[model samples]
Structure formats: structure tokens, C-alpha cells
Target chain A: MAVVTSRRGRRTAAPYAFLAPAVLLFSLFILLPVGYTAYLSLRKVQVKGLGLGRGARSEVFAGLENYQRAIADSQLWSGALRVLLYGLLLLPIMLGLALLFALLLDRPRVGLRRFSRISIFMPYAVPAVIASMLWGFLYLPAMSPLNYVLDKLGLPEPNLLSPGSVLFSIVNIAVWGGVGFNMIILYTSLRAISPEIYESARIDGCSELQIALRIKIPLLIPAIVMTTVFSLIVTVQVFSEPLTVRSLTTSVTSTWTPLMKVYRDAFAADDLYSAAATSILLAAITLVLSFGFLRFVQRRAFGEDR
Target chain B: MTSTPARRPRPAFLPTAILLIGAVYCLLPVAWVVAASTKAGSTLFTSFTFAPSGSFFDNMGDLSDYGGGIYWRWMINTALYAGLGAALSAGLSGLSGYTLAKYRFTGRSVIFNVLLAGVLVPGIVLAIPQYLMLAKVGLTNTYWSVLLPSIVSPYGIYLARIYAAAAVPDTVVEAARVDGASEFRIFRTVALPMMVPGMITVFLVQFVAIWNNFLLPFIMLADDKKFPVTLGLYTLLNRGATEPALYSLVITGALLSMIPLVAVFLALQRYWRVDLLSGAVKA
Candidate 1:
């Protein structure tokens, strides 16, 4: 009985022993930081007499004041609206191309399937910084092959980096980098479908396009929802691409995106309190958007909780 | 097998054309970078895009000579960060995921749910407070600031949990236990081997993620010596604004930085399509 009890005790502690490191790391990094952000967001700085020395400045609690300020900040609202615009422009076009390419690749007897798949998915390996930089130069009128070809054709050249068109240029860079990854995801899911289903559909006199439209697209909704949510979260952040492009042109501002605004407020403006508030706001919006989207899609598509 | 005839279908023209167009759109930038990296600084803007030049080695030499070869330092730093960070992350994820999947323990679902919640939090929210917290401890600019945050990947652990549940069987563990194997020993010898393929997928995914991470390193490290390739190239591009000559170097550096990743991607091509949630690859 003593031996059996000892063995049972050891078994009980085994999982915690294995999980110790992950739990510790998660607490230190994820849990602590989020709690600290919430704490900082509720606090404001108080300046004492003369405001000149170490103890002269101190943190004081200001309930919801920072949130109020964040709500009223025109720059942040504008940044949010701009990101909304960017997402509106980016999601449909990028996901459209991804779905198109994925369907084409999954087509029967498709030529150059391997080459096309590899070439299309290759950009997933390139970092956003590099992708933006590469496309930034390509958008340069003097160095652009597009402009050169237009010149030869006696057509007017478009200035891709100009303020009026820089957003479109950014969109192009994003599409170039993102379409391949999304295509691969969609294609992988497409490949998961049993071929027997397709064969039966074909035997029923359905064309390939009709099968894709009727069967494949309908079955791909869950994957499409997932990709859409992930892309939304990423697109809202919108940091590296625009940050990289800002070096090449003046169109992208220091606070081009909400995340960039958080950076500016935290480091440049030395406003950690407000930055913390903005960070919390952005995170709240992200969570709401993602979970809201997931719930809506799940209810509509599956009629049950995932 | 069914007794249906295996007839060869005719090649589809329209589908192939659309796929080819996508291939071109995706490959055009990579092709441009390969060509642009070879041009001399003076003619970088003047030369026709996609025209290869003889200054390939010269541009590389200039990149090598720039700032006492800090580009190589950035490369090593990136490799170290990605390599070591991903290794440690994979190990932790494997242990925790295996334990979570196999053991019936108190507070298990709560813990897993909390960790999954970490995945939904925007990185900016974490990055800002992490920077401040690190600063409070006087470790903001250290290698740890970046590597520590990267180590606890929720997504990796999630994948690992799914893999362990699928790959590691209870009967094998029961057999090992009956043989009087210690828990850790049973895990190391009996279960870990089965989890290796899944762990490799986790390792590769985390590796690329850490390598391609820009915001964390950008926010944390101010020292040029410690900057990863992404941040380093970004700064070089910023400087290129003042001196157009450095644009060629940025171009060269970008091209050089992609080689290791592209090589790894090609070598491990089979693992790229592993579905993290299901831990299955139809291929």
C-alpha cells in the first residue's frame, strides 16, 4: 500500500513538473505584461512643486481619463480609419487572388503545377521589410520597369510613391507578399477534400468550374473565415511594411498606423501612460473584431460553437 | 481499388494561364531583387530594371566592407536569435503539450484556455509593456528582451498539444509504465521519438516566425551590433535616404539575408503544409 500510494503521488505531480517551464515563461511574458499594461493605462503622472527633481514627478491614478483622451485623439481616429480603409482594400483583392490561384492550382491536369505552386508560395519566405523595400524601389519611377514600358508605349507614367498613390503601392506590396501564403493555406485545405467527391460530381455531369463554385467554395468557408480573421488582425497592426516604405517616400507618416502611433507615443513622445491606453484600446478592438467575427461566422455557417 | 480506367485528362489552358500569371506576379519582385543587387550604385537608378550588371561581387564586397561588416553580425545575431529561441521554445512546447495531452490534471483546461487567449492579444499591446517592464529591470536592450518574449509561443504549444494527442498513444505509455520506467525517462525515450516529426514542424514554424519578427527587435534593441537582419536593413534603408549610394547596399543586404531562409524553406519544403490545428498533412 505504501509503494502504490508513492507511485500515485509521483504520477500526480508529473504533469506540473513538465509544465513548469512553459507556465513560468507564459506568466512572465504574457500575463505580467498584459496586467501591467492595464495598470499603466489607468494611471497618470503628477507633477509636484517646481517639477524639477526625482520625487517631483510621480504616478497617480486617473480612472478612465486616458481612455477618454484616446477616444478623442483625432490622430488615432484618423489612423484607425486609415487602417479600416487599408483592410477594406486589401482583404477582398488579396483573398480573391489567393482563392483564384488555389482553385487554378487544384485544377485537373494543370500545366506547370509544381512550378506555379512553388513560385507563388515563395514570397512567404521573404520578410515584410525586404518585401516592402523591394517593392518600394520597383515603385520608383526612375527604376520601375512599368514606367519604362509605359514610356516606350507613349503612355503617361504613374508616380507610385506620390501621396495620392502610395496607399495603392502599399496595397500592391502587401498583395504580393500575402497572396502566396493565403493561397497555400487555401490550397492545402482544398487538397484535404477527398477526390471521390470530385469524381462523383464529375460523373454527375458537373464541370470543373461548377464543382469548384458549388462544392469547393462552400466547403472552404471555415478556412476562408480563419484566413480572413488572421488577415484582419495582421492588417490592423500594419507596422513593418509601411514603416519600411516610409524611408523611401514622404507619404507614410510617423504615425501611419495605430500600432505606429503606440510606438510614437511610448518612445518618441515619452507618453507611456497614453501609449498604454492606446495599446489596450487597440487590443480590445482586435479581440472584439476577431472573436466577433468568429462567433458570427460560426453561427451562420456551422450553427454551433467551434 | 476501383476498376475505373485511368485516363489522362487534356491539359487545362485557362486555369494554367491564370496560375502562370500569379506565378509571374509573385516571382517578379524576387527576380528584380536578384537583378538590382548586382548593379553598381551609380547606375542603380539608371539601369533598366531586370538588367543584370557585372558589379555583383563588387556590391557584395561593399556590403562586406560597410561598417566593419556589421551585416554579417546582424546575420549571425538573427541566426542565433532564431535558432536558439526556436529550439528552447520547441522543447518547452513539447514537454507542456505532451503533459497536457496525456495527463488528467487539475486546472488543465483553464491553463490551456489562458494560453490560447495569449494568441489573440495583439503584439503591439505586449511589445509596449514588455519594453517598459524590461526597462524597469534594466534589461531593455539586452538579447533577452527579444529572445525571452519569443520563447513562449502560444501557437507552437497549441500545435504541439494537437500533435501529442494524435501521435502519442496511451497504450505505449502504459506499457512503458508497467516496465517500471520513470515518468521523465518514459517521456524522453518512449513518447519523444514519436513526437519528433511534429516537433520538427513546430521548430521550423517558430524559427521562421522569430527570424521574420521585426516589431520586437525593432522596439527592443538600439545597438546596431545586436540588430537582426530585418532591423539592420531597415536602418540602412533609412540612411539611404541621405546617401543614395547605400540603397545599393540595402538592396544587396536584403538579397543576402534571404538566402539562408530560402535554402531552409526549400530543404524543408515537405513540412511547410502541416496543418497546425490538426497535426496532419494529406500529402
Candidate 2:
């Protein structure tokens, strides 16, 4: 009996053993890099004459200098503000459209539901760089259909890549690429709702819109909150769209977004210390914002259980 | 009781129309790309925007012949990266998620929370640090630079955990154990088959994530030969702004890049059971 019990104990340990690879990989790749970034954020280089040889430029421990520099950098601040503006333009519009499409698909008698869903969701497959490239060309005054129509009607053409219009251009690309996936997520959650709830509401003479507003949307709060948080997180990391757009327009400077600024500092300006500090600062701000947002949503949406 | 039923409220036409309008807005850029790819270089700017010419095939041929088939090479590299990376990611996520879900192990919550924290660490914040670390090991600009990082997906593990908890029953695992089967044997033979659909979902999600990835590949690789399609197209577009002649090739390349992914998405449409909140709730 002791031998059999020992054998059982040995067998049960296998799952944990199998899991070791994933945990090890996560530590080495994810945690170590993050910690290394934090560490690098606190250090800088001390240069000697000409700043040109290996030993001439020695590593020095600079405490908070990089952080102070990052805080004072107007370019970085403007980039963050630009992303905020872009998010302001993007989040409500994208989530609103996603919820609207989801509710529409849930309603009966909608013509061509499958076709529209597939067509709308198709863009999510395209990468942001490619999507921006496609839209960038379409936004060109010479190639755009809108411009063509305006010209035919003898009307003025709008420049999408103009300095004032560039933020909206970037936001529009994000909304186009994002709305469909969020729609599918919300739609899937909508489908998970038991039909009995809606049937009883119908029996009570509630209209479809009433049912949707009071029942469907309320029940979809969890999904909505999840999608919103993810959208916010992704919006904070906006890099590829503006980067691709920058290639086509001079108005999009290298420091158009915080991440873009970090890239430029690290790779273009060769200021790794400043870039590391800026990245760590961005990560801290994102953590505080997201956690704060999550707390607010949980209190308001999920109440005590969450 | 036999009387005609009272009239029901008609569906809200305004909101539905507004939603469809939004859908059109979402689809407009894609439609424009299709139309733009068909125009010749001379006609691209001169012709009416919606008019189709017969230059798509010619542009593709020219793009293929440029720099001895560099565009095709990008496509192949993208496929390899996304395909292999997703496969390995799915395997690791499956194993880890299964263990977390089924076993009553110590430090489970600690381990799981640590992994979940990774989901919140935005990719951009990690990219610069990851690049610097890779530079130390002389691994930058290599395939490993991209592939190594791509294989560890916290979100994938999260999804797989939810799937394992919901899909795999404890009773079956107990039964396999009672029959003298090893834990690994039971997982391989019993749990894995039950988890196939879930694993496929994880694989598709990871594949799309990896394929659509730009910043990582952009930072890690500098060699044009190793560039993925997205980076390669960006460089082409950058050059096109100056040369103007490369415009048609850029358009053609963009169109071609959409085909493989669109095909994969359509084929996997039925399997994408995206229960975003349910996954978190289950955890």
C-alpha cells in the first residue's frame, strides 16, 4: 500500500514538471527584460576626450538624471499629449461602433449579417503597417476618391496628412482596424446570453431597443469593460501606424508618439540612457492609469464581486 | 385568445443604418486599396479614383522582378515567423495552462499572477529593453531575435487556462490516473484531444498577433532580406514618396500581403470563440 501511494504521488508531479519550460521562458524573456529596462533607466555613460574609444566612454551611475531629462523634454510631453488626443478621438468612436454593430447583428431581420460581419472583420487580419500604408495612399489628394469627387464638383480638397488633420488621420486608421475585432468579442458575449431572459422581456411588451438597452447592454458590461481596457492598453502602445504614416508625410515627426520618441532616442539619437528612462516612465504611467481605470470600472460596473 | 396579436415595436432604423454606415467607414480603406492596386502608375493619379485598369498583374510581375524577388522573400519570412512561433507558443501555453488548471500545486496563484502581469506590460515598453539585452548577446538582427520573444505569450497562456478549466473535466483525468496511466500520458492522450479546439483557437490568435506584429520585428532586424512583409512594405512606401515610380509596386505589394491572412481568418472564423470576459472571469 505504501509503495502504491508513493507511485501515485510520483505520477501526480508530472504536470508540474511539464509546466517548467513555460515558466522558465517567461522569466527569461519577460521579467528579465522588464527588470533590465528599469535598471538601465538609472544609469548613464561618462565620456572622456572625443567620446570615441571603448574605454574612453565608461559607464557611470547617474541617479535620476535620465528621468529628470525625460520629464523636462517637451517633445516627449507633446508626444504623450498627441497620443491622448488620438485616444480621445479613437476610443469612444471605435467602441461605440463596435457595440452598435454587435447589437445590430444580434437583432433579427438584418440583411446580409454574415457578409457584413466577415467584410468588416476582414481588416483586422491586416497588420497596422499595411493598413496605414493602404489608407495613406487613399488619403493622398491625387489618389483619393473623395478628392476626385471634390475636384469633379469644383470643390476644395482636404489634406488628410496636414498638421492639424494628422491626428484624426491616425485615429481613423485605428478605428478602422480595431472596431471589427471588438465587435466580434462583444457579439460572442451577446450570443452567450440565455434566450429565456429576452423571451420574458418580450412577454412583458418591451420593445427590441428597450430589451437591448436595459438587458443586453447591461449584461454585456463585463465584455465592454474588458474590451475598453484592452483598447486603452493598445492605444497607449501606438507605434506602427504613426511610424508608417511618418514615412509618407513630413508633418509626422519622429517624436509623434511617446513610443516613437523612445525609438528615436534609442536608435536614432543613440541616447539609450534617456530612452530607457523614458520607457520606464511610460510604463509606470501606464500601470497607474490602467490600474486606476480598472478599479473605477470594477466599482461602478461590477460592484463588490470584482 | 384567438384575437390577432398586438403590433410589436419596429426595429430602430436610424441606429441600424448608422451602424451599417460605420461598417462602410471601416471597410472604405480596404476597398480603396483594391481599387488603387488595379491602376497603372500613369493612370493612378490621372484617372478617376474608382476606375479599374489592367495593371494589377503587371505591377505584381514588376514587383516580383524587383531586387531579385525581395517582396516574395518578405512574405515567406513572415509566414515562417508567425507559423513557427505560434505553433511553439500554443504548445507551451497548452502545457502551462493545463497544469495550472488541473493540478493543486503550491505557488499556483503567485505563478499565475506573475504571468498575468505580463499582459499589462505594454509591448512598446519592453521592446527597447529587449533590444538592448539582445544586443549584449550579439543576437540582434537574427531570426532568434524575433522568434525567441514571440514564443512567450502571457495572453495565450491566459486563454489556454480558461479553455482547459472549462473544457477538460477532472473526472476523466482521475479516471486515467486510476487506470495506472502516467500524468503526462493522460494529458497527451485524454486531455489534449479534449483541448484541441481550444488549442486551435489559441494558435490562430497567436498567429494573427505575431503576423500583425511590427515594432518587435522593426527593432530587432535591420537586414532587408530578413524583413517581414509589413516592414518591407513600409520601406517601399518610404521610398515611393520620393521616387513616385515605386508607388504602383507598393500598392501591389500591400494587396498581396492581405491575401494569406484574409484566407487564414476566413478558414478559422468558426473556431474563434472570443469570450474575452469569460476567460478572465473563469480565472
Candidate 3:
């Protein structure tokens, strides 16, 4: 009995020893940072007369003041609202196109499938900053072929970077960079379905479109759910595109997105306490929104995964 | 499978048309950058948008000459950060994942759950606190500031675990153990080879994530010499708004930044079999 127990202990111990490095690194880099941010969010900086010297400033505990302020800030709320609109525009169009392309690629008769897949997935390799830079140049009136064509056709050239059109421009960039990767993900899952499933449908005299609508779409619910959640998380943290676009036009303000506001407050304005608080708020909203979406979807449709 | 009435074959027009439209949308910006990079200063706005010009080499010379070739420094810095960071991340993930998959351990589920939770934390919230902690250690604005934080990727570890579970078998480990090999030896000689394909996938994913990352470097470093191409082009664009002549350099630099990634994607596509959904399904 002693020998057997010792051997069992040894077997269990090896895995933990190997996992120690990953556990330690995750604790230091990820876990600790999250805890530290939450802690910092509850504090405030107190400045004494004229704020002249080092001793004049001190940290004080200000429970929920920062949260209230963040909640009340019109700019931050509007930024969140703007992102909601952007997500509404982006999620359905991008995911719809991805599913369509994936289904098309799965069909046997489609020509240039490989070329289209690679070309579409090519943008995922490009960084968001570079993507925005490239798209930004194309948006420039003097540098755009669309504007040149409009001039030739005697039509008014619409400004893509203007206040009214900047959101759509940003959404277009996000969709272009994202759609292909999602398509590949869905396509891989689609390929994994046994061919016999589709063959039986064909033997029963079902058209390809009918087979896809009934079988393929129902089978792709899990992939769609996963992609939707991931896209939601990414869209909430929409910082790089707007930040890059800010460099191109004055229409983008210092506080264009919630994360960008946090950056500006912390780095540009030197308001670390408020920035920390705002970031905590943003993080909370993201957690609630993502998990909420997951719960809702799981309850309604993706019941098997949970 | 449901049965339906037979129908005539539709022309391969609608799907082809929609896909071509998307491809053109994706390609338009890239095409514009390539065409715009050829024009000389001020000709960027003055000439026809897509017309070819003769100043491509001259613009490259001008970008190289700008600020003592700081653009090249940015490029090298990006390569260092992405290359070294991804390599270290892949190594760590491989070891940890193999252990988790093959060995039956106490607290294994707890550790994995914690790591998965790390995935849900948005990166910005982590960046601010990480900067503060690094600053306390007097390591801010240094290479380690970016490299150290990037080494521990939750998603990489998660993928590695999935790969190891699917690819490696416990029977092989027992065979090696019976042959008097140490645990590390078995891992190195027996397990590592089996895990290569998975490690390569992790490496590519981490490489792209780190290379394309902007927020970490944005907050970690302030010096222009330490800037990655993403941040460098950002500053260039900011200044371009003031000096229209800088547009050509920005366009040229954007085109140049894309070459390495395109080469990597084309070369590495074979190893990029991602089964993230399958893992989720199994769990």
C-alpha cells in the first residue's frame, strides 16, 4: 500500500513541477496586473495647496467616486454608444459574409476557391495599425481612385474621413481585416462534417442550397457563437484603428473609444487615478457584456456546449 | 438530411461576384498604397491617383534618409520583439502543455481555469498596471518591458494543451519511462518531436499577435528609436497631417512593413491548422 501510494504521488507531482513555470508567469504578468488594476481603481490622488512639491501629493481611498464620475462622463458614455453602433454595423455583415464564403468554398463547383480564400485571409496577416494606415491613405481625397472617378463623372466626392463617415470607414477596415480568419475557422469546421451526411441529402433529391440552409447552417451554430463572442470582445477594445485614424484626421477626438479615453487620461493628461478608475469601469462593462452575451446565446441556442 | 425538389443548376455568378467584391474591397487599400508610394512629394495629391510614377526608388531613399534611418531601426525593433517573444512563448507553452496533457496532476483543472480566465481580461486594463509595476522595478521604456509581458500568453498555452492532448499519447511516455529515461529526457526526445506541428502553430499565432500588437509598445516605450513600425508609422502619420510631403514616406513605409508578413503567411500557411472550436466542443 505504501509503495502504491508513493508511486501515485510521484505521477501527480511531475505534472505540477512542469506546470510551475507557466503558473508563475501567468500569476506575475496576468493575474497580478488585473488585481493591481482593481486595487488602483478605488484610490484617488489628493493634492494640497498649489500642488507644488512631492509631499504635497498623496494617495487617498475614494470608494466609488471614480466610478460615479466615469459613469457620468458624457464623452465616455458616448464613446461606448459609438462602439455599440460600430459593433452593430460590423458583426452581422462580417459574420454573414464569412459564413457565405465558407459555405461557397465547401461547395464542389466553385472555381478559384483557393485563390479567394488566401486573398481574403491575407488581410488578417496585416496589423491593425498598418491596415488603418493603408485604408487611411485610400480615404484621402487627393490620393483616392474613387474620388478621381467621381471627378471624372461630374459627381460630388464623398469624404470618408469626415465626421459623418468616419465610423463606417473604421468599420470597413475592421471587417476587411477580420472576415477571412472567421471564414477559415468556419470552413474548417464545415470540412470536418462527414461527406456522407451531404451525400445522403443529394441522394434524397435535395438541392445544394436546400442542403446548406438546413444542414450546414444548423451545424455551424457553435462556430458562429464562438466567433461572435470573440468579435464582441475585440470590438469593445477598439483602440488601434481609431488611434491610427486620429493621426490622419481631426474628426477623431482624444477620447474616441473607452480604452482610448483611458489611455489619454492616464498618459496624456497625467491623471493616473481617474484613468485607472475608468479602465476598471471599462473592464467591468466588457466582462458583463461578453459573459452576458454568452449566457443568453447558450440559453437560447448553443445549449450543448455549456 | 432533408429532401427537396430538384432545381436547375444556378450559374456560378452570385457567389463569385460577392467574393470578388470582398476581395477587391480588401485589395483596394493595398493597391492604393503601392501606387501612391511611387509618386514624388506633392505629386502624391497633384497627379492621378492610380497613375504610375518614376519616384519609387527615390522615395525609398528619402524614407531611409529621414532621421538617420530611424525607420529601419523601427523595423528591426519590431522583428526583435515579435521574433524573440514568440519563440520563448512557444517553448514555455510546449513544456507546460505536454505536462498537463500526459501527467495526471492534482490542481490541473484549477490552473487551466485560471489561465482561461486570463484570456477574458482585456489587454488595456493589463497594460496600465503592468507599466506601473515595471516602472517600479526601473525597467520601463526598455526591451524587457515589452518582451517580458508578452511571454506569458494564455491563448497560446490553451492551444498547446489542446494540441498535446490530441497528438501525444501516455503509452509512449510510459515506454520511455520504463527505459530508464528521466522525465525531462522523455519530454525532450520523445514528446518534443510529436509536439512540433502544434508548437509551430502556436509560434505563428504568437508571432502575428506580438508583431501586430500596438498598445503594449505604445505604453511601454517613449523613445522614437525603440518604436515598432506600427507606432513609427503612427507618428509619421501624425506629422504627415502637418507636412503633406511626409505622405509619400508614410505610404512607402506602409508598403515596406507589409512585405515580411506576406512572406511569412505564404511560407507558413501549411502548418496553420487551427481547431479552436473542436477544443471548445470537447471541453
Using TM-score as the measure, the top candidate is 1
Cα shift from native, residue B279, model 2 (Å): 3.4
For candidate 1, the docking band is medium
Q: Relative to the unseen true structure, what is the C-alpha lDDT of residue B194 in candidate 1, on a scale of 0 to 100? A: 88
Estimate the lDDT of model 1. Answer: 0.86
Q: State the weakest 10-residue window (summed lDDT) of model 1 chain A.
A: A297-306
Give lDDT: candidate 2, residue A201.
88
* Residue-wise C-alpha lDDT for candidate 2, range A106-178, written one tens digit per residue: 8765555666787777778888999998888888888878888998999999999899998998898999899
Question: lDDT of all the models against the reference?
Answer: 0.86, 0.83, 0.84
Q: Return the clash pairs for model 2, or none.
A: none
DockQ leaderboard ranking: 1, 3, 2
Which sections of candidate 2 miss by over 4 Å? A1-7, A49-54, A292-306, B1-16, B276-283
Higher DockQ: candidate 1 or 3? 1
Which ranges in model 1 have alpha carbons more than 4 Å from their true place? A1-7, A292-306, B1-9, B271-273, B277-283
Per-residue CA lDDT of model 3 for B73-190, tens digit only, reads 9999989998889999999999987876676555666777677667778898899999999999999999999999999888788788777777778788889888878788889999
Q: Taking the tens digit of each residue's C-alpha lDDT, what string does model 2 give over B16-73?
A: 5765676687677777777878888888889987778888888888899988999999
Candidate 2: lDDT of B61? 88
